[model samples]
Target: MTRPHGRFQQAFAKALFSSTEALDPAMRELATQPAFAVYRNTVMKACIDALEANFPAVARLVGSEWFRAAAALYVSAEAPRDGRLLHYGSGFAEFLRGFEPAAELIYLPGVARLDTLWLEAHAAQDASAADAAWVARRTPEQLAALSLRPHPAARWAWFDDQPVFSIWERNRAQGEVTDELAWQGEGALLTRPYDTVTWQGLTQASCVFLDACAGGATLQQAAERALAVDVKADLAAIFAGLLSAGAFTAPSSSPASNERTP
Candidate 1:
């Protein structure tokens, strides 16, 4: 069912990252030309550059030489599907998890994941964040029955075995790591309530609460889930902090219908 031009396009794309011998007999001469070599190199460099920009924390963890080298391998295996390089490297974090060179640095994958989340938040659709005052206007009974939608720009994750948020935050900010940095599990929350993307470290309980909310749980149900995760969690403080951080959208009569899972 493939058209001739479509087949040629696919072959040409593959040829860019492969040897000229892989090209069809009709196009083999073109692939060996000097201009073809230059074009191929340019495409490869662009992909590597996109990965470097997209996964800055990973690049910072590894030196430029190492990062680019690994990125080159990734580029060969998975090229961008479109012209939007900002959305490239969506699978970089997962790739790093199975990458042999990164085996010793287990936290690197988590840091890469956080970096991807940052990009997702930055590129997410615009929406007004719900303020604490919105919750204040509701009665206790009304609040219990109301479901909260996560803002379209909100992204969060919990790294169970690594203090990924701490490491990623310091690296992303280009801050120096100190000896006092603890090696423990950590979570991260990234949100763009307004024009700029903002992030902060979170506890596992907070991540659980957000997950519950994203699944269309009511505020009271989300809080209960957070408590189930950590009996010592301060529900009032967590709820207030999340509200202040613009994590949720304004409550509506049909919150579940408008829900956008983070």
Candidate 2:
């Protein structure tokens, strides 16, 4: 009942996955062993470097050895689940939250998520940021239906109690911390228009809009949904804010495409 090629394919896959550690003797004897081994090491290194690059603040906080060890273990245990490595580390923050070694850095996961958003936004298609002219082109009814795609660089982050974005900015700019208010819990919106990645502090209602848009709702719907959290929420102002930040994508023609806005 066994097929020869199927068995070889299965064994080959196992070998490819075993690259993070070393090539087992059984795999080492294959004709393409050297190439496969190198490829595996490269994949592992890419993931490690990516984790390091995106979460540089975390690396700075935890130091190199510990970061690399943890990143390596993470990559080894969970290979990337997507073809695009841009947002592959999305789950990494959650992983860190649960990982034991970095237990002391309670906010490290949120920090990592910020870094991941920066990377993803930077990698998004560099369409010209939507202009006021585009906004002017739409009628009120069209505006009502006007869906937005958050700029390729838009990232929505939530924090329970740590003003992580503020801390990141201050440390990144090498500013001395004179106030303890930086630790207060707050969410953030990270956006990049070209080369600059900036994180702005956000309010709960603002976070609600972002999360709603991120859930793939239309602009008007996103606003209405967000306003449900607060009767006085400034829906128009928030939409303008998001547009100015280059957050939003037009509704795509693909009927089956239900991708969540980032």
Candidate 3:
């Protein structure tokens, strides 16, 4: 049997997420004041506020009322497991996928996922980017044998149906949202080169190359993977882009303790 305190806490949690009128009779009697409703409203508001901060693009696209309604349902169904609200709603994208109201918005889940990743990358530990100059000086054999380390904040996502990167950028940009775009599959790479997190749309070859590097493959291996994905991919341009974007960390100076391949 559950202890009284345990049962009370469970009931209180349920009531917190449920309607005010649904409170247990004992709890209701204990809080015989209109202030109780204020408390409930405050809790709900805090949840909504956190979701708003974490998913600004989604909120902007969905409009306030719709977002609030969806957020309310999400909060009731999936309360934060921890007090760290920054990382709250980790599963919100998945939640939106099954949400009846958002069912028609096929691009929503991908956008939400990208937003979540942005938050995560923003909070990740900082590290210096691999020195492009130093790598450029390496001999062909040396470069082929060396493996680039993944940056602490490096992240990428592939969208099969929507131009998620474009949509996210448009919504985040200043001024009115642009509706004139040819929706198509897109991939995005995110990294924190400096203070701010940045994202860029990627080609399939770029995605494959980065995926290979992130999996600890050598430069030669990653290049081969990229070529396998797209024989015509501009390997030089991809390499330059990755270098300029600071998507990798110097193997020797990696903050993580992972082994640096020879």
Candidate 4:
């Protein structure tokens, strides 16, 4: 059952977003007050500011003025569900997909998604990353049989037709896109190995390998999946790179029996 205070709180929240004329008699009077307007504006500004902070790459790609305007529209449609603003704007990427103004910038949504992944990786739970030494300790047969768990702080995605990772990385590092940049598909991987979040561009094969690993595939099976995507994929180099980036968690006591070789 809805408690009296809970109902009042919900009504007050709705009134803050709605026009004064839309509120009940009591709320309408309160909403018309100067303080109410100030509070509403402040709340909206805070949400917009949070989004700008969260998706800095997107904001940098588009100028601040444009980003803020778009963010304001998003804020009006979706309020923060979590008290912590760090987790806000989970839907901003999706909003960009359908946003008419951003239609011309085909890569905007991908950049926004990467920014969100970075935040999520940064906020993920602490875990010991599987280091190269850990892998070296296992024999080839043992490693092939083992199913590696992805680190809690790891996030990755592959973009089909846009150099999304390149664009995002440049803007994220406050660098300009050079004329030499190739317009091709790219993948991105984000991992918080230690204190700071780190990101690197990935190949489609690598992304597919990670996807297979996340789905409980053994090392050999994941390699096969990656090879299926790119016949010439360098499995050894890709595996080493992922290890260096701390993408996988420390191995469990034993291999998962449910996983099978193909």
Full ranking by lDDT: 4, 1, 3, 2
RMSD of each: 3.3, 6.0, 3.9, 4.6
Q: Count the backbone clashes (under 3 Å) in each candidate.
A: 0, 9, 0, 0
**Cα lDDT listed for each candidate:** 0.88, 0.71, 0.85, 0.91
Write out the backbone clash pairs for model 4. Answer: none
State TM-scores per candidate. 0.92, 0.70, 0.86, 0.93
lDDT by residue (1-262, candidate 2, tens digit) is: 6698897766665665554346556666762557866877787788888778767777877888999999987886677766666666777888999999878888788777777777777776654455655676678888777665666677777677887877666655655778766567777887775577766777667788877767767667877877897789887777777767756553453221234334
Candidate 4 lDDT over 1-262, as tens digits, reads: 9999999998898886676777899889888889989999999899999999999999998999999999999997888889899999999999999999999999999999999999999999887788677678889999899888889999999999899998899899996556676889999999997899999999999999999999999999999999999999999999999999999987655342123232
Residue 49 C-alpha lDDT in model 2: 88
Candidate 4: stretches off by over 4 Å: 176-179, 254-262
lDDT of 2: 0.71
lDDT of 3: 0.85
Number of the top TM-score candidate: 4
Point out the worst 10-residue segment of candidate 1 by lDDT.
Answer: 253-262
Give Cα distance to truth, residue 156, candidate 4, Å. 0.4
Model 1 lDDT per residue over 134-164, tens place: 5788899988877888899999999987889
lDDT of 3 at 246: 85
Q: After superposition, how far is residue 61 of candidate 2 from its true place, in Å?
A: 1.9
RMSD of 3: 3.9
Evaluation by TM-score, superior candidate among 2 and 3: 3
Q: Per TM-score, what order, best first?
A: 4, 1, 3, 2
Off by over 4 Å in 3: 1-14, 18-33, 177-179, 253-262
